[model samples]
Target: MAPSNQLEVPQKSRVTVVGSGNWGSVAAKLIAFNTLHINSFHDEVRMWVFEETLPSGENLSDVINRTNENVKYLPGIKLPKNVVADPDIEHAVRDANMLVFVTPHQFMEGICKRLVGKIREDAVAISLIKGMEVKREGPCMISSLISEILGISCCVLMGANIANEIAVEKFSEATVGYRENKEIAEKWVQLFNTPYFMVSAVQDVEGVELCGTLKNVVALAAGFVDGLEMGNNTKAAIMRIGLREMKALSKLLFPSVKDNTFFESCGVADLITTCLGGRNRRCADAFARNGGKRSFDELEAEMLQGQKLQGVSTAKEVYEVLSHRGWLELFPLFTTVHEICSGRLAPSAIVEYTEHSARLPLLESPVHLN
Candidate 1:
C-alpha cells in the first residue's frame, strides 16, 4: 500500500437517471454526451427502466441494452452506447453521486421512499418532472419532496422542452432553478447544455418549477380552443389570459416568486410551446373533440402509447389547492380549465368562464404561503 501521507485522487462524479420514459431517455443522451466530453464526470451513465415485457416477450431493459434504443417509448432514436439500462432502481442509483429524477409526479413519493437509504449521502438531485404533489398540509413541489425525503439539495430544470425534438438535436432552451447554490446549478447547466440545447440558471426555484407545472393547465385551455376550431385571435386571447392566471397563482402561493422569472424560457416560452404542440395539448384536443365523453385516461393510452399527460392531473391538483383555500374565483382561467377537465363544465365553458373571470382583480387578498 502507498504511504499514509500520499494524497489520494478525488473521485469523479457519477450520474444516474432514475426513470427511462421518453424525456428520461433524452436526458440520459444529453448527459451521456456531456460526461464523455467533460473531465469532471464519469463517462458512463446509468438509466433505471421500469421493466415491461414487449409483445415479442423480451424485457424492455434487455431490448434497450441490445439495441441501444427505447423502442417501446422513443422508437428510432439510439441512446448513447455508454447509457446503460438497469432494470433495478436501487442498483441503478447506488453508486452515483448525481441523480436525475424524471418519473411521473404521482409516483415520486413512493420512489423517494424506496431511495431513502439507498442513495449516496452526498448525492445531489435535479428534477425534470413538471408537476406537484398536494399533501395534507399543502401543495409540495417535486423538488421539495425529493429534498425533504432524501435529505439532499434538489434543483429543477424546466423550459420549452419537447423531448422528441431535443432527441433529434433540434434547437431548444431550458432554465435551471436553484434555491441557493449557484455552483451546483451551473454544473447541472453544463451537464445538459449543448450547441442545440442551450441552458441557463436562475435563483428562483419555485417560480421556475411552478411555471413548468401551471403551463400544462393552460395548454388544456389552448387545446379546447383548437378543438373548437377557434381562430388565431381567440387562441391568442386564451394564451394571454392563461399566462396572467399562471403568474397570479404562482405569486400568490409563493410571495417570494420573482416577476422576472415569468420572462424566462421556463415561463412564457414554455407556456407558448406546450400550448401549441406538447402532448398535453394534443391529448386535450382529442378530449375536447370527443365532446369530453372520452376520459383523458383513454385518450392518453390511445394517443401517447405510455407517456403520462400532466395537464389533466395538474388541473385536478391545482383545483384541490384552489378550492381548499377559496381562491378559485381569483383564478378563473385555472378554475375553468379544471372544471372542464373533470366534466363539471363543458369544453365550451372555457371561453365563457375565462372571458368573464379575467375582468376580476387577482391577488388582492392576503397571499397564503404553504
Candidate 2:
C-alpha cells in the first residue's frame, strides 16, 4: 500500500507471422483467436504476405485486409478481423517480439537475409516450416537457420497438423520443441493450445524437427505404394520401415535426440498422417500413376493450387547430405524417394529397397539399424 508510486505495467508481447500460405493463414487465425482471450499478448496479429495479384487483379494483402480472408491461399476460411496482412516483410515484424515463420524451406534463406538486423533484439522465433537446407558443410534445420541469421533463439512446432482440417476446428495435437528454456516452450504451448487444438512441448528440438522433415520423404514412398496398387499391408510396411529410418537418421545426425521423442505427436503420428494423405503423398501418387512421365513440378502446378510440396525437395536435400557423407545406403527409403523423384529410378523402386532395409541390423552404431 505504501508503494503507490512504484506501480509498473507489464509489456504484452506482439506476434507477427512471417508467411501467408495455407498453413500460415491457419496459424495466424489460431494465434489471433488466442491473443484476444489471453492477457499476455496483443490482440492484433500481423501476417506477412509475399504479395501476389489475384485472378481478380486485387493485391493479396489488400484483399485479405478488406475481406478478412486470404481469398487466394485460404479461401472460404474467415481469418480473424484482427489478423492484418502486410506485404512489407520488415514492417510486418519490426515491432513484434514474437515471430512465427511458416514459409517454404527453399525461400527461408532469402527471407532471413532480408530480415537481418531488422527484427527486435529480444525477439524470439518459432519455425512451423518443416524442411532443411543442405549446404556444403551439412544440413541446416529451419530453426537453426533462423537463430543463426537473426541472432535469436528459435524453437519449432510440428505435428500431424493438416492445415485445412485444423482450420475448421477439428481436434489435433502439436509438439513444440525448445532448446533449453522450458518457460519459453510453455509460452508457445499456451499461445497455440485451444479447445480443439492440443499443444505440448518437448526438449528435443532436433528430434521433433527431423521427424517433421524426414517423414515427408517417407510419405513419398507411401504414395508410390498407393500408386502401384499395393494393398494396405504394403503401405503399412512402408510406413513402419519409414518410421524406423526416420528415428535412425534423426539419432545418427543428432546423438542427443531422445528415444521417447519418437512417441510424441511430432514423431509417429506425423509420419502416419503425412504418409497417408499429405500433399507429398498425393503428388507422389500422381507421379506414379503417370509412370514418372510427368515431373513433380508439372503435377504440383496441376494440384495443390499455389501451395508447395516439402517432400520432394526435402528428399533431394537429404539425399545430398547422405551422398556427401557416404551414408546413402544407410537410409534406403530416403535414398529411393530421391532417386525416384529425380527420375533416376522408377517410382516402383520404392519397394525394391524395403526388403534390404528390413534386414539390416539395429542402428546401435552408425553401422547398424537400431
Which structure among the candidates has the greatest TM-score? 2
Instruction: Flag clash pairs in model 1.
Output: none
Candidate 1, residues 1-370: lDDT per residue as tens digits? 8899999887899999999998999999999999999999999999999999999999999999999999987899999999999999999999999999998888899999999899998899999999999988989999999999999999999999999999999999999999999999999999999999999999999999999999999999999989888867888888898888888888888888898998999999999999988998898888889899998899999999998888888999999999998778878888899999889999999989978876776554445433
Model 1 has an lDDT value of 0.92
User: RMSD to native for every prediction?
Assistant: 1.6, 1.9
Question: What total of clashing residue pairs does each candidate reach?
Answer: 0, 6
* Weakest lDDT window of 10 consecutive positions for candidate 1: 361-370
TM per candidate: 0.97, 0.97
Q: Which candidate is the best by lDDT?
A: 2
> Candidate 1: misplaced stretches above 4 Å?
1-7, 364-370
lDDT of 2 by residue, 257-351 (tens): 99999899999999989987799999999999999999999899889888999999999999998888878988888999999999999988888
Question: Model 2: how far is 194 from its true place, Å?
Answer: 0.4
